[model samples]
Target chain A: MPTSNCSTRSASGLALRAVADTLPLCIAVIPWGILTGALAIQIGMSPLQAQLMSLLVFAGAAQLSGMTLIASAAPLGAIFASTFVISSRHLLYSVVFRQHVTQLSRSLKVIMAFILTDEMFAVSEAHTKRSGQFSALFALVSGFSFYVIWNVATLIGILIGDTFKDLDSLGLDFAIAATFIAMTFGELRRFPVFIAVLASGCLSVLLKPIFTDSYIVIAALAGMLAAYVLGQEGET
Target chain B: MWWAITGMALITFFNRYAFFADFVRYSPGAKVKRFLSYSSYAVLTAIWAPIVFSVDTQTGFTHAGADYLIGVSVAAALSLLRVPSIVVVLTSAAVFFGIRFVI
Candidate 1:
């Protein structure tokens, strides 16, 4: 009876985990959405433009970078270029997600592609690994939920941004950086992973001078290459 | 703005589609799977190292602020202790804010 109960609990837990995995991404979207709206207003973007960007792009990093560039009165080319550089990581997300998401319908896949962001990708990938089950429906539900919450939060932020003008002074911005660091560190439990991280750090530092704004992309490629070589050797 | 956003969306979609098409039609080789598994660390580290190390400077190496160092130390310790992620985040943020206020 105890063993049977344990199995039942495990099965339910797996299902719950699938649902709960998306919760973090959804919660995180709210703060970032608010930040985008507030920043857009502060930078003189009209509410319509701010909302449109949030609705369409659905990328926090690119939107933030683009807004910063716009505020600085950078040329359109420069703004686009900077946004591209910051968002290049999405390419990696798309590639990784594609492997598991391919069996999904074309329409569903297209929609997932639009809503894919760093947190959503991380949660989705982790869920896949943990559950050992691939349900495109789950992925769609998680991704779509996150996307909706994000836009709603942005709208809220735009509506009430004036009331929270002191958000920066409160240092809430640091939460974003801290959250990512915590998440990454939690995931790094093995030596190969640790070494890959170190390699990436070194490469980013080494390449910063030469690559300027594109150092992150260069570092990611170099780190992946190094880790791949090392991981292959370990397997052999 | 429309052109740039649309272009980016297209490129991103294509990149994602390539992976689905490639892996679905043919399983990725062991080497590629190994690479993908290990790639997360490199990608994340690459993103964060710059922020932590270059928080003060624009391009070159410089002294990371005490709060930054303390925050990371606390974070690393919590990670090593195998604390839950949410706890680590909240504690580290609290530590950073406390230090920032105290000194």
Candidate 2:
């Protein structure tokens, strides 16, 4: 039987509630979208290509990293490698969500998977974690709406193109750093995880400037392994 | 360029859909789950480190520059205080432009 505070709500109600839940986060993303769109045009990307990246990639970190690399004239392989490493976190996200959505139909599963971004997952997870109910309507409404909002933000950015110069000068890129740092700190609820994060941060710093193409991947794997090893030791 | 985008989309879709591919039934050990939980920090760490430390300049990969460091420090400070990410971004921008305008 259904239970919890969310059990009685209609899908649309839950959807609105989910949107409401994420309203502050969404407002924050608007400026980011505008900044990215403007950067894309600034970096010699066609307005169409910029918008297309927003449409297709749908991952801000990936898109920003991609645009930055392309702007720096990084090779194609390096660009792909960097973005791929940045996004590999989604692999874990898919794993975490799989058990919840397994009972749903394949199409819904596909949509759920497609629309799963960090913020959407964070907001929806807050609700579903309590109830464990993978309501299709709720998930769809939340994720799809986030998707629309991101696209609209990107469009606004594209429209505002090129008056801004030097993303670093604007310090807008710090938003991403802040977001990622929040994600890191959010997970550090345990004492031992501190060791894991420290290991990761140090390894990444040391590995930077060493491997041109795959430092991020190497450092991340090293960090995860450090955590896994230390965690196992701590448990034993 | 289109190929690059297409290839990336394929990689990402594969990841998002990978666990549901019938292979995810073999749940890993508790250690793996615990480890996966920290993957976010690890990944974010790797992504942030290079950007924060290795600031590119017209001359070379020399310094983090006042703007980048100031921006990062402001964002990091506000974030530590539990400000929202969007607000952190806005504050960083405001501070950056603010300082530049005065001096």
Candidate 3:
């Protein structure tokens, strides 16, 4: 009984820490959420539909791309294909996360996998590295908090869609870029990772015309190959 | 519309859950594991490079505005100095907005 109580207390503490760590990211998330909502309305989605998409699909980039395709009158199959391409990067995140979450039960793993996003992966990976342990409670708290904030922000955007028509010019989307830059800068300290980043960025730009949206997946694979080759050379 | 949303949701979830499924029992080797470890850096770079570099799909090269360039540089510098992520993000946002105003 005492052991279980102590574990619960520590879990709550970890959850609190996760919330604190994730709060700043909300500034970035809120703007994107609002923008996504406003754009969804502009593209003829009912408030309910937009909210449902945010609740169900729950991925910003994929949702945005899907909306663009839908606006262009793309078929449902095209939308599904583009969403798959846009979200292929998450496959990598799941693979990396699998190692850490082996201790979790199947149902918990399902929940964990559901909340797996770029921000979630970044925050949770940083936490595991810092604490030398991964707590499911911490990851869930970080993720579900983002989930609630994002959906709420989307609702706000839907409510004020007409009045907030100028949200695009405010450069709110840059917040996501800025946050990513902050995160990637830390990873660049490692030599092999630096090479990998360079490779990915270069290939992404170079292959954009040839590969279009699929370039993200291809370039990322090239980057990983670059890092692997460099690691083999003992340059890490 | 509902069909599209359902399809997107299922596909997105499947991508996230595929590796964790009960059927995926194969363990990766050490070298494969090391390669997988670089995935975050690789994927994040793949996502941001085009936006930051202004790699126009049509024209192939447009200048990334000074505001974005400078904002990202400041963020990278602060992150290198081991500043807190929150500070780095806010500073970069401020720098981005401040530059947009001036120019």
Best by TM-score: 3
**lDDT for each of the candidates?**
0.68, 0.69, 0.84
TM-score per candidate, chains pooled: 0.79, 0.72, 0.93
The TM-scores that each candidate's chain B achieves against the reference are: 0.79, 0.70, 0.87
Q: Distance (Å) between predicted and true CA of A209, model 1?
A: 6.0
- lDDT string for model 2 (B47-98, tens) is 6766667633455444345766776678667766767555665677667657
Worst 10 residues of 1 chain A by lDDT: A20-29
Ranking by lDDT: 3, 2, 1
In terms of lDDT, the poorest run of 10 residues in model 3 chain B is: B54-63
| Model 3 lDDT tens row, B1-103 | 8899999999999999988887898667788888987777777777777776756668866656888888888988998887888899999999999999866
Cα lDDT of model 1 overall? 0.68
Q: Write the per-residue lDDT of candidate 2 for residues A10-65, one digit (tens) a residue.
A: 65577787776556556557767887898888888787888888787888767877
Query: Model 1 segments beyond 4 Å from truth?
Result: A1-19, A22-31, A72-77, A135-138, A160-170, A205-212, A233-236, B1-27, B55-60
Alpha carbon lDDT at A177, candidate 3: 74
Docking quality category of candidate 1 according to DockQ thresholds: acceptable
User: What are the chain A TM-scores of the candidates, in order?
Assistant: 0.80, 0.73, 0.90
